[model samples]
Target: MTNQATTLPESFRELEPYVADWALPTRQERYDMRLSKTIDELGEFYDAIAPRAEEAIGYLNELDLNDLPDDATRLLHLLYSMVLVSYPVNVFKQPRIPDSGAAFFDTVAEPSV
Candidate 1:
C-alpha cells in the first residue's frame, strides 16, 4: 500500500517499500512469507533493516506499547518479519528450512504487542 509509505514515521520511511509484504500481523504469516521468497529477496530485506533495528527498537521502546500509534504498530510488525528472515539470510542461505520437506509450524496464538 502506497499509504503505508506515506504514513510511516519519517525516520523509518526508507523502509516503507517492505511494509506491504513484510508488515504481517502474526508469527505464522511472517514465517510463511519468509519461505515464499527467494534467499536474495530475504537478504535484501535483511541488509536494509538490520542496520536500523536497534534504532527502531529504541524508538518503539519510547512509545506506550498498549497504545502504539498505527505507524508504530506497523513498524513493529516489520521488525518481526525481519526476525523471520534473518535465519535464512545468515545460516541456511535458503528461504525454506534445509531438508525440512513439507513440514511447517502452526501457531495457535501469537503474542499481542
Candidate 2:
C-alpha cells in the first residue's frame, strides 16, 4: 500500500461519555512521551514485527495486518502512526536477514475475519 499514515476513527480507549471507563493517556501526555520522540525506537518496535506481519498491511509490500491480533494491531497502528515503520526496513530487511530471524519472537495471530 501507499505510505499512508494510520489512525483510528474513534478509539475504544477514548470513547466519550464512557471515556473514563477505559484508561487512556491524555493526548498531551501521549504527545510528551519521550519514547515517541524518534522514529528509531518506533521503527525498532516495528522491525521486531516486520518478518511476520504479512497477511496484515504491515507486510513488506503493503499495509496488511493479517498477522497480529486486532488489539495488538490497533495499538501498534496508534503508536507508529503507520502500518510499518521504516526502521526495520532500513536496518534489517537486507544485510541482516539471517540473524534477524529473531524478528519473529512472540508473534501473534490476527483476529479472525
Candidate 3:
C-alpha cells in the first residue's frame, strides 16, 4: 500500500504520477487536456499507460462501471484521457486539431456509465 491515500488500485499504483494531470471526468476536458500538452508530453503518457491498458481494462471489467469505487472511477477517467491523447501521440504529432482553426468540441452529455 502507498503511504498517501490510494487513488488507484494497488496493482496500478505506478500510474499514480499521472492521476493528478490525466484523470479527467468529461470527454471535453480530456480533449482539452490533450490540446494543452505537447506531443512529446502526450507520448510520454501514452508510453507509460499503453502497456498497462489491457491489464487496467481487465481489472475494471470486473467492476460495475455505473457504481465504481472512487479509485476505480479515477482509473476510468485516466483511461479516457489516454484515449483522448492517443491520436496526437500516434498520428498527428501535434496538440491542436490539424487544419481546423478555432474548432472545438463541447460534450453535451457525458456517458452515463
Candidate 4:
C-alpha cells in the first residue's frame, strides 16, 4: 500500500522513506498498482451497481455494456468518475470525496521523460 502511494512524483518528499523501504518494486508492480487503484475504487458503490443499477442503464441508454464495445475500454475510468465525481458533482457543483476526508496535495516534480 505504501509502495503504491509513492509512485506519484509530486509526493516524493513525503514518500521518500516509504520508497526506500525496498530498492523498488518491478515495473509490473507499478502496473499492478495502477490496476489495483482502479479496482479499489469499485468499492465506493459496488454494492449498488454490481449486479447493476438503473443509472448504469440510463447513462448507458441505447448502449450495451456487456458487448465488447468501444466505450467498454473506459469502463474503469467511467466508473471512477461516476463514483468519485459525477454523481455528487451533479447534485452540487462542488467536489467532495470522503476518503482522505479531503486530499491535500502538492505538485513537487515534473518528469523530464
Best by the lDDT measure: 1
Question: CA lDDT of 57 in candidate 4?
Answer: 45
Per-residue lDDT over 1-113 for candidate 4, one digit per residue giving the tens place of the 0 to 100 score: 44444432322223223232222223233223323443334343343333343544455455554553433323323333334433333443333333545454443553321
Residue 53 local lDDT, model 1:
95
For model 2, name the residue pairs that clash.
1-62, 55-66, 56-64, 56-65, 56-66, 57-63, 57-64, 57-65, 58-64, 68-110
How high is the CA lDDT of each candidate model?
0.88, 0.36, 0.85, 0.35
Clashing pairs in 1: none
Candidate 2, residues 14-59, lDDT tens digits: the string is: 2122112111233333223322335555454444444433533333
- Model 4 Cα displacement at 65 (Å)? 12
Candidate 1 RMSD computed on C-alpha atoms after optimal superposition onto the true structure: 2.4
- List the candidates ranked by lDDT, beginning with the highest: 1, 3, 2, 4
Model 1 over residues 1-113: C-alpha lDDT tens digits?
Answer: 44453656779988888888998889988887887899999999999999989999999999999999989998999999888898899999999879999887699976787
**Preferred candidate (lDDT higher): 2 or 3:** 3
lDDT of 1: 0.88
lDDT of 3: 0.85
